[model samples]
Target chain A: MHEMALMGDILDIIMKDAESKGIKQFSRIDLIVGELSNAMPDALTMAFEIYKEQNAQLFTKDASLHIQFEEAISECIFCKTVYKPDFKISICPSCHMPSGKLISGETFQVLSYEGE
Target chain B: MEVKLNTNVLTNNNVAADYNRDLFHKTKTLVINVMSSPGAGKTTLLEETIKKLSKQYRIGVIEGDLATEKDADRIRQLGAKAVQINTHGGCHLDARMVVATLPEFDFEEIDILFIENVGNLVCPSGYDLGQNHKVAVLSVPEGNDKIPKYPQMFMRTELVLLNKVDLLPYLDFDVETAKEDLKGINPESTLLPLSAKTQEGMDSWYSWIDEAYQACLKQ
Candidate 1:
């Protein structure tokens, strides 16, 4: 899965930043994953475990991944109806038009990390 | 200590994609990233597209596969410059992978570059390869539920090429329903039904490319 690649990129960013800050070991990784981000949190967690196993020296034995899940929400451009969207392009319940603009739920970012 | 990063996980890929986009813009190349599920007739569509447009414009292709140069060879047989990128085991092609193959082509001579992404609808749509347009090919045999089933791919793509319409006579695939589903998933996306094998409704695809090329030149 591409989540592996995404996780690799995340680690690369953290490793670079951590090395510069003189942080030798990681205790946890915090991430924000959205429902519409096209990345699965389960897959990301699995990837983190694999990477932690491979680079044992850089991570604590119980290093964990913390994912803040974001729900998908869309607002109708025509009717101004706010509702949870099943997909990116959703039909407005009030106007019955596919004019709902996504307000959130496409984020996939690393928020912070715990290390020393 | 908790370090505040607040960085996008795909920052590296996005950066590389932006760089590739700049290069394509500078060279005035209309790059199209074509994606679909395995065996959705992407190669066939490209082959026919190249054959029809080669007379008017110089075309180049970057073929992505887990392991093979067969698709690239097919394009090469048509007299167009093609470079194949074998991902080994990767499901999709990233912007960096595309940047690595940029040196193989002389962009000055290439008017349009079609990137036939690794045949997976899910992963390829997530990665931007600095293309002017993202097109998803959904064959008739794939069923009508694909649009709803794989909303991520359909949502991000601007165009859906409904290929293999020649087999529509025997199959239960409804074109109108597919259109409605796509509209529900992506209101702005247009679905073009064409049979790459029989050369039916291909003119519209060629015209779309023509319009896209003109639009690229304007920018």
Candidate 2:
């Protein structure tokens, strides 16, 4: 639901980074989101579509945005066990103790962007 | 050309949060960001807390809702400063929203500031509003599955206030199981059982606030 706001930030970052590099336009924007981050990639893509249409002058008119997801993985600090829970339970499979230290799947980052 | 730019999507939010943190530190204000599912008794608990702490401390509240002045009105009825932020349809209140409300508070006169985040188990936990502590409220009727189902919320908060404990006798909810579940998700977090309506087991909450305030002073 907050994808619009996040999309706006993503655009700002892309624009700022592009300006610093003296790039006129980019052909693709690559984004990475984690499963645990609660970000819906479809919604984010929709938001970027609207944002891109509104700011056509900022980038190549046909540039596309792509988002990749990272699966959520939890690690048990007690037994050094790493596993993926069903997003409902963080209990370590071996120890049966709750472990919520997430090593991945919460990544929300701009991995890269292609330029003309 | 492909430019590899690995940067956080929420960098802007984090920068705004840091700004709010600096202001909080300079004013020596104890700010607590409270989160929960809707109807989890967050506002009721805040109302009672304000009434009890008003005599000893000057309190202010920043109420975040989709659209409503009702919460701020309730806090104002207690004769404390309360400002309301309407997110329209937004699920969470971001750091910029809190920064915008900073001027509304007289930081020097306000000893404590409570930000009642927009009620939702998932969204509110991700954004940092530059508070001293993050507290989550869970009620008896919301069921035990909430703690595990919404692990993100419980995992991030330091304290979980199990509200509506007075209804324990009528409901099948187990306080011990809830406590154990919270420990499983967050071993360092504390689960405090209390009923805002009955005012049962509120002393520990007050003591916790007092200790937090004292720690704020030292900072």
Candidate 3:
């Protein structure tokens, strides 16, 4: 019930499929997860499951669900260069700076979907 | 054969974070995420640092704690713009929270911003708070073994402030092994052992700030 409120925010934008056929059933979803965003995969999945039950009358028995994530990359706030760090890149490889304002990698986006 | 749906959950938040990033770049503000275990001298180091650099550069601070605005008040008292984000029960400050609070500070007047992350070593490291760098403090009382026990914090940091060194002689802390593990994981990291309370090695700490600040200017 609580998730419906939160999901309502994300769902409002997701339902604006003006060009494609209306979402008959959701097959999968693509998401961009910034390393800094606090999107717990477990919590979101549980939330989605609850939403599915709430609107159970709208879906088929075999409708599938898949979630994909994109790694968030940060750009240096000072140099205006993307902090293309190796997951192991500890500091700024270019300027030897310790940390910079995170430019990206704190995201939650639905890139595209294969529904209906 | 084709379905196109473009949506973003954190789009609004990301828009603000990007705007903040652009502001930092345009103004050449060096941002740092300062994190540590509770009582590890992060605030003490910051207080001492503000006293030294406040005259040369316009400094600001975003204090993130589970509760209390005491740290924010301390920064403001020291003559700096301060914003406090009480996560309430959350363990760390996320990018959204940081972005949401940017309007509270005058970014143009600020040359540097210290994000005093909640006194945590784990989950805080996992979240990005729009900081320029991640700086971690490990006080002697907390033991140097913290490097290996909390490898991610040490490994991700650009600088590691081994604070409370004045208490080294009174405790069983092993600086040698700590250095070895830290260097092994991140050899490129600059390590400065000092006492924030006693002001020991504050120069090295200042040197780091100057260096990072200069880099921002150059960029």
Candidate 4:
């Protein structure tokens, strides 16, 4: 939802700052939500639809939303193991000890998008 | 002619988060976004933390919940600057929400800012609120199996607080296994166990805050 809200805020600024031809149609919206970030794509799409209907003039109110999901993967420093776990485990499969370092999925990203 | 516009949806919020992060860094204040399941002792820990650490570091809290000024009101009574950001029905606090409340406290005077996120282990972990650290609290009363149940929340956390330890004597929890699973998923994460009610072993938490605060000073 942060990403979605952030996008909304950005769209507002972009529309205000660059008043080129306004919006016609929109295309793909690639989102890199880590396997861990519990964001619902369908819910986001629904919210967007409502928002677009309300402010259709500023955006491509009829554009289709396409989402690309990114999974969260962590590296085990102790055994140097790299794997993706079910969104329910926090430990290395091989080593049972807690780690001294953890790197985020860095999976959070908006790969790209295009207007219709 | 049809125009094809390539734009990133999250571009604006990322910009704002970057801005918020820079602001935190400039002020040399350690911002910790705290999250957990509802009834997971966020208020208990925040209250205890303010009482103990306020003398050494100026602490401020940005409390997020579905509805209520109650938490914010409680923090204010502790003599720390507190601001309430009600999500209405949202699951967590995003960078935008935190930025909205930035004007409430003097970041310059604060050594640490505790953002008590809405009580949910899942959604909040995915959103970055421009903080130095993300701390997760898991109360023992909630059960030991929470580690495997909510992996992402524990995996991304900088530190995990195993609260309500005082109730351990009466529960069927395997503290070791929970810690093991937690370590398995997030090995480098700091684990602190204590009871907010009994205040048992809370000194470690205070020390951890001090360390995080000092690191902020260096930045």
lDDT, candidate 4, B53-171, per-residue tens:
88888888999999989999999998989999999888788788888998887887888889999998887887778889999999887887887887778877979999999989998
Each candidate's TM vs. the true structure? 0.98, 0.94, 0.71, 0.82
TM-score between candidate 2 and the true structure: 0.94
Top candidate on TM-score is: 1
| Candidate scoring better on lDDT of 2 and 4 | 2
TM-score of chain B alone in model 2: 0.99
lDDT string for model 2 (B1-219, tens) is: 888989999898899999999999999999999999999999999999998999999999999999979999999999999999999999999999999999998899999999999999999999988999999999999988888888889888999999999999888899889888887777888999999999999888999999999999999
The true-structure Cα RMSD of candidate 2 reads: 1.8
Full ranking by DockQ: 1, 2, 4, 3
Q: CA lDDT of each candidate?
A: 0.93, 0.90, 0.72, 0.75
Stronger candidate by DockQ (3 vs 4):
4
Name the candidate that leads on DockQ. Answer: 1
**In model 2, what are the clashing residue pairs, if there are any?**
none
Among all windows of ten consecutive residues in candidate 1 chain B, which has the lowest summed lDDT? B121-130
The order by descending lDDT is 1, 2, 4, 3
Model 1: what TM-score? Answer: 0.98
Predicted chain A of candidate 4: TM-score: 0.64
Order the candidates by TM-score, highest first — what do you get? 1, 2, 4, 3
Residue B151, candidate 1: C-alpha displacement in angstroms: 0.6
Best by lDDT: 1
lDDT of 4: 0.75
